[model samples]
Target: MTEIIKAESLSFDTLLEETSFTVESGSTSIVVTGKEEVDACLVRLLLGFIRPASGRLFMFDTDISTFTDRELSAVRQRIGLIYASGGLVSNLKVWENVVLPLAYSNKFSREQIEQMGLAVLNRLGYSGKLMALPGHIPLFQKRLAGLARTMLMDPDLVIYESPLTGLNYNERNQFLRIAREFHLEKPGRTSLFLSSTPEIVPLLEDARVITFTQRQSS
Candidate 1:
């Protein structure tokens, strides 16, 4: 099996325990860490947002710790991150936030990205106003908006952080369905969900579950 993500003895500032696991390509994995800190820290580490205190992290067979800034950016562009809080820039409109990353990359013209942003959001069943600021929208819309941004990137690996936390059954099911179908769209697509809820295990079909509890400090 091709390994998409591998962590060897990875730990960070006592927030997370020494953890090592491999997520193979085209597989789904759920990492349920009861502690919010540990869950967030682990996601950040995997996304290369923060450095691990010790050990190593490898993404797509490249050691992220050893990568230069330019190399790391290239790697990250291939990964999508869906935050629990929608991860929008508060000051920007929903449309702007949705297209922010793509706009920054400068891969497409402004008009092209603007069209793609709204198109994906609508395709994902988001009917909210694109002109509205993030704080003005409901949680479900916020979640969808963030997901729409991810879809624009067409990432090979998608990392979800507490995707079902505050949503109702219908909303949760819709989100899960969209995410699941997205992962299945490509044979080599991989997904990793970091959540604190044990109930999520059943929601993720065929996912390899890994339960993590933070260690007590001495």
Candidate 2:
């Protein structure tokens, strides 16, 4: 199997120590639970946003620690990250938020970008809210818009950060269903979920779950 992500002996100021795991290409894995600090640290580390104090970090077998800013940016384009709050631009409408990345990348013309954005949202069952600002939407729809944005790029790896927090049980299940929709449709795409709650673990289909615990101070 293709090794998409791997980290060994990952540590940061006692928040995480000796953390190791492998995420094979097309597979799903959940960082089941961890202290908030540690979870954020791991997400930043994986995205190459911040360097770990120690250990090896790899993306497709290339050590991320050795990557330059440009190289890391390129790597990031292949990864999709859904932040704790949806991460939509406050000023941009929902459709604008979804297509911004594609438009900025210059890989497609303006017409093509809009068509792709609409296609994604339609697939995810969003209609008539494309022009609405994210702040005006309900929390569930806001998150769904975020998922639509993430899906627009058809990223190689998708990372969801605390996607279920503050969601009611039904909302949480809907979120998982959306994720599974992607997984089922794109069997070759890998996903990584990071959260401090373990309740969502059982709902992840065929996911390899790992929990990161902070070491107690001596």
Candidate 3:
């Protein structure tokens, strides 16, 4: 498998200094922070939302920091992100939501996009909501919709931001099972990067944990 994403000595400073350990492709790694807050800077840094102060970030061997918007869009087209809040377009129906990425890339035929969306939704037990607007569905189902959207494109990498958040134990377990199944089915084709609170560590031992410690003032 190719090295899809890599980061070296990623760091940021606002009120405090925050650093992330280097990460490479085909490897499952987690970032845990001592602070209660999620480090949006680190997350954005890795996702190419922002540039690092002085470090290298590569996607498919291309330096992401130097990529033009069009170039970055091409790279992002190959990556799927399941945001912390289930980044669904509230007005869009489930099917529409699933096809959003394909629409952006202009790579899928109408038939192909529909088939892909339905296949993922069916696998996630969400077939009934194909025409339902996102706001109408329950929170868990909305999250499932987000996952479906991410999975529909079958991208090389999927970055999930707190996928199990706001779920009860049973829901979390169900999501994990589905995620594991998805990973196994794809084998080496798709890699996953998950971010969550430290509390989830025990549940996800299969992942490499990188705890983020806040740097103190000199």
Candidate 4:
């Protein structure tokens, strides 16, 4: 099995340290009860946005710390991020947000992109919100649209940062279902949930778990 992420003694500021772990391909992992700064720093480190303060961070056997911005950009395309804020362009409609990355790469024509966007939204249990402007849609649908965008690319690894942060009980269950279905439907697509809520951890069945409390020394 492929190793998607491996970190050893990772530290960033006072938020993280001695955080050693490995995530294999097609597996789900969670880091529970993480501080906000810890979550942000971990994502930054994984995405190669910032260098780690100490220790190593590797993505698919490549030491991300050694990569230049250009080198890292290649790897970034294979990693998908579901952001806490949904991260959709406010000016774009829901469908537009879903297809923006595809459009940028010229991987599909305008008509093809539209169909692909609609198809992904449908698969994620959404319909009829595609034409709605981002500001016009509810926050839940906006987040779903963001998820559709990420899924359209069929990325190798998907990272969910506080995925259940603002959701109510039912909404949280729905989101978890979608995430589980997405993971199970594909082969070799890994997932990492970085959340501060310990309650959300056990919900992801069979997931390897690590906690910020375990990484920090008293």
Given candidate 1, what's the lDDT at residue 85? 89
Candidate 4 collision pairs: none
Candidate 3: clashing pairs of residues: 32-212
Give the TM-score comparing model 3 with the true structure, all chains together: 0.82
Which candidate has the top score in lDDT?
1
lDDT of 3 by residue, 133-173 (tens): 87777777887888888777676666767766688888777
Stretches of model 4 off by over 4 angstroms after superposition: 127-136, 214-218
Q: Candidate 1: misplaced stretches above 4 Å? A: 105-111, 213-218
- Residue-level lDDT of model 2, residues 1-218, one tens digit each, is 98999989888776777778888999888886555556677788998888888889899779998998999999998998887778889999888888888878888988888788878887777654778888888777777788888888789899988878878998888788889778767867998888888887888857889877555668
**TM-scores for candidates 1 onward, in order:** 0.92, 0.90, 0.82, 0.90
* lDDT of each residue in 1-218, candidate 4, tens digit only: 78889998887777776678888988999987456557767888899878878899899888987788888998999988888768789888778888888998887888888788878887777754677788887767877888988988888899988888878888789888888888887888899998888888778878888776554356
Q: In model 2, what are the clashing residue pairs, if there are any?
A: none
RMSD of each: 1.9, 2.0, 2.9, 2.0
Write one digit per residue (lDDT tens) for candidate 1, span 16-93.
668888889889999888766676787788778899988899999989888888988889888998888888889999
Of the two candidates 3 and 4, the one with more favorable lDDT, higher being better, is 4
Highest TM-score model number: 1
Report the candidate with higher TM-score, 2 versus 3.
2
| Local lDDT at 5 for model 4 | 92
Error of 3 at 66 (Å): 1.5
The alpha-carbon lDDT assigned to residue 17 of candidate 4 equals 66
Name the weakest run of 10 consecutive residues (lDDT summed) in model 1.
Answer: 209-218
lDDT of each: 0.87, 0.82, 0.68, 0.82
